[model samples]
Target: MSAPKPIRSIVIVGGGTAGWMAAAALSRLVRTGVSVTLVESDAIATIGVGEATIPPIRNFNGLLGIDENDFLSKTQGTIKLGIDFIDWTREGHRYTHPFGEFGFDIEGVKFHHYWRKLYAEGKASWIEDYNLCATAQKLGRYTTPVADPASVLSRLTYAYQFDASLYAAYLRAYAEARGVVRTEGKVVDVLLRSEDGHVDAIALEGDRRITGELFIDCTGFRGLLIKGALKTGFESWKHWLQCDRAWAVPSANPGREITPYTRSTARRAGWQWRIPLQHRVGNGYVYCSDDISDDEAAATLMANLDGEPLRDPMLIRFEAGRRKLAWNRNVVALGLASGFVEPLESTSIHMIQTGVSKLMALLPDRDFSPVERDEYNRQTQIQMEQVRDFVILHYHANERTDGDLWRRVREMDIPETLQRKIDLFRNRGRFFRYDDELFADSSWIAVLLGQNVMPAGWDSLADAVDPALVRQRLDRIREVFRRAAEAMPRHEDWLARNCPAPTASVTRKTA
Candidate 1:
């Protein structure tokens, strides 16, 4: 056997949030001598669908050395404390899935269990009151968490809602400033190596051919390099997630206070997202095509906008699944090329960030060892399935009988993993995190309770605490959180003072 060859050239196909994210990560993380090249054409458009993100995004940006304030200003970003799920359990029903932990653990017991005891007696305040992020978000407040362990502000975790397109531009500039090379062209054909059946080079429209030791496909749902060229297969998860298409549009803010959280309102056949940014609101209706027509979906989105429409609704087609092998041979797929779990929890960009981080962790030589690829695929599969389950929980645990779409999801069988989770939660509110899955126990509890999936029994250990003490602590905690939120600066006021974007560069468009 010959000696292993180190990867010298890295080629990334497509350019968008995913492509640029990979570029930025590789350019910064990859050591010297390994060149990173991104090939894309100006004619291609990315889905740019996910505007809101989860809390983990802070780590991703921190890795990129991005200043939070600058990123917010440049990307027209606003704080996202959590997601307000409206009409999901039923019409007019609402709940907030926040980023931070709930009431602090008292004497080594979960707070929710004690709350459950009170909740059953109709004495506990809404579960949202125990969470700093949710409480503050409800009060239109915004503040970054502090490092001090004693301060309530320490628990105020959050994410961001930003312009996806602008984020890509910002990352492009960052990646270029590093060492990633940007190639402007469209891939017309692919050349393969005979021995290994790996992509050898890609022919551009203008007779330019670029070759590399490895390829990263960020070609969105088309999977231009992974599936189109390498013939990698895909796994459809439509049965679990029926929302295969989305219609997106931006709207003016209409002079209302910018809320520091995303709102997902359940529509007749699907759900619509309202994400507030510094300049405009990003709204999208993600519906199952089989249940709703494109025209009706578009109309529903238009009629529900909080402000005047700024652009024609852009339709995006997708399948809720992933590639059978994210790293097939020498090709690795990212973004929609890998798979989509929708934006219900604002995970689109976070998935991309994770993909990049995993790839870097398993960086391989030119030989592209199967061990590395297999590990990458295994990790990716686990993370995707975990996220899929979380998103599925939102759809599968619905109480709404008003729509066929909800009925189908409600009655349909889910993965055994998710089933077991629901069962455990239903038993005594016991839910465990496996392999460091992205969603925490608090998140599960939030959704479970929000959708009215109550526990038949609270943890018996919760009974150890004196009933009077539990009540006293719960009331004190709730009141403290409420008063703290009431005192913080408003979301809009916070942005104006710190990270406000330059006055809308383009005139606000109206329908």
Candidate 2:
């Protein structure tokens, strides 16, 4: 019946996007007499290929009070309207999963429902036509969205393509400036308490002992604290997500106009990602090792570069899964330390951001109640599963005949949750969002339709609207999006005029 004591000292192990982000976000606690210390070794390198992101990142930046323009300039950032998936459904086919919503809803019926009816009647264009982000991406345009509800430009949403290392450095400076202590050393050992089996302190290589009330693990895939010390178990999803290896390399810019989107081109054995930053382009080939050799994967990546290779390809090995308990005992895991779904959708950093957000929301006291721990675990598992299913959809719904990888994934048994969504959409375009999943209805609609998964019938409610009126409205919306995109500045021009990196040279090219 005693009052719970508040946590005082907080220690973050490892430093990269995850550790620095946790430090920066928790820096506010310094004013409340809670010490935040981050320990990292300068010798360790991070997997910095997480250059693309979704729109929620803007909210994360806003939470940190980061100036958009300044952050872009410092991080060599470029706008990412969404991902352009090439040859995913089938060879020679393409589609975009844009960040913003599709056409406006009509009379309480979803816009896609009306579009489906119109499409079936040969009166509608591609779903991307009604999306301002997709239109702007196609036109190579860039601009911040407006607040006007009536304007087509107001519907635009975007994320960033930037150097992950530069972003971590930027956040490190921010955290350090806000009084978060940074210790330079590698952790040699983790000491645990006797009675409760909780992490008591970390022993550094140089005979340093750092003690804290709460510990955060950001040690990449090593899971140094959460799994290494606490013995937390991992639940692997490798069978469902089989691409466990990647060959990453950077390439020189081709001097063409920078695009406002990320490009994911499906390969014979896997897929390749192209993320353009202001200074250079980030490229990677993620594939299953069983289907392709490391050398072959690297060769494929090098052969497809738009420009000269900047460095030798780096091979990365990983499994697609999450720790069974993200919050085990008093230790919380973030980023790769917690789990890793492939960066196909660029959810790595977003996962770290959400972990930090959830930690803040359910911050615990010295008692470390199981109630709080259980809730955090539940939320984390659900969110990870949702993302896993979304990523799986891209592979499962493919129509490619290039390699066994595609065929196997397509024929594989996906999670029942994903199956339910696909089944519902296939029936009558009846898709539903569960547990407030990360990808919204618009996202699902885009991938479902883009990959040629047509619904058998339109929503019953869509039948109430007049077909002619729906077609007219759809035509008007498409034209408005096109004209609005045309009015925006070129992506390169916008970067030059607003937040170009010091080393970036702007080049104008006809779209």
Candidate 3:
């Protein structure tokens, strides 16, 4: 006769970006008469390596009622217009995978259709010319989008490059201010209910047993709660992902105009990531363990840095996989505890946000309904698998013959979903987004074309359009993007004037 009451006590095990993000989002929705406590240890170290993010992160921040400028300043963040992929297509080729739409659709047909017609007639320009973010990134320019539909600024989307540890600290203050409790100690044991085998509470090092109606595991690759307690299985994707070990380090900024994008350069055995923050640059070499030794990987990472290393390159070992079930019994796993896909596409933080969001949508009661867990796991499976395929496309679809790593990846068998997408595009540059997945059409186009996967034929409808008119329209689109990008302020100059990070007493200075 009455609506079901939500769970009252929520316990978050572990802390870092994942733990605090769950706390912050929950604090907003479950403010009154609900207890949310987080348990973390000073001795346990956080990976703190996911510095770059994709565009969806902005939406998560907006939903949390966070100001972009404040968040940027606190995290010492920099704008990320897109990612610059170097040597991906071949030994000497490069490409830009920008954030927004390529151009406007005309007469109920995609804009790329018309451009394809012009290409066939030998009159069209490069695809990058029509992309605002690519042009702006090339010139180190950045500007916020406007609400006006008629302007090219309307579609400009961007993300951020920040220090992951600082972001966790910032969110900690926010969550604590909103009444989320913080417990400092290591978890010694997990207690499960005898009746349903659900986790009831965790025992801390001080012999303190804290009980809760629900639990969230943010324990990085260890999977203490999801795997250790509930025994969720893992599905490895190493064959497609290839790279499993990474050596990360921070270096002095090269001071080369501070471009508004992340750069991923293909290497002899793996790839190097260059993420430019406001004060310094974050660099890492991710390589396959079988192809190269840890010593070789570390040296390769250190030798390629643009500036002197701030510290020794930290070694991180990971398996490219996903938890078979993200939610089991009364415990839900967030962040690395759930699973990992390498940081190639910057999907780490985004995955954590999505997990918390989906939990809130299907927020359960003390009764622990199996139906909700089933649906949550189903959705999570779809999201992760889709992302996995996208990441694999970058490695398996390459034209590089550089070394064993590249050669093996190029010849590896790919998932059917990605293979179908590649085949469709290769036959004709046609890509369709399914069920509003994470990456959109423009993302696929960028990587496909960037890796030299050209369409063998154009759409038949594209041929119906007049060639002269197509060329004229295509030229206009490129010019509009060029003019819009030129009007923007330089990325470094804009940050200094609008959202500069504060200088800290410890760690590093905010440039």
Query: Which candidate should be chosen as best, given lDDT against the real structure?
Result: 2
Determine the C-alpha RMSD for candidate 1 after optimal superposition of all C-alphas: 2.7
TM-score of each: 0.97, 0.99, 0.97
Ranking by TM-score: 2, 1, 3
Pairs that collide, model 3: none
**Minimal lDDT window, size 10, model 1:** 502-511
lDDT of 1 by residue, 389-491 (tens): 9999999888886878999999999999999999998999987888889988889989999988999998888988899888999999988888889888888
Question: Residue by residue across 1-511, what tens digits does model 2's lDDT show?
Answer: 8986988999999998999999999998999999999999999888888999999999999999999999999999999999999999999999999998998988988898898888888899889999999999999998878899877778999999999999999999999999999999989999999999999999999799999999999999998999889989999999999999999999999899999999999999999999999999999999999999999999999999998999899999999999999999999999999999999999999999999999999999999999989999999999999999999999999989889999999999999999999999998998778787899898999898888889999888998877888888999999999999999999999998899899987687654
Best by TM-score: 2
So what's the TM-score on candidate 3? 0.97
Model 3 CA deviation exceeding 4 Å by range = 1-3, 504-511
Looking at candidate 1, what is the lDDT of residue 39? 98
How many clashing pairs does model 1 include? 0
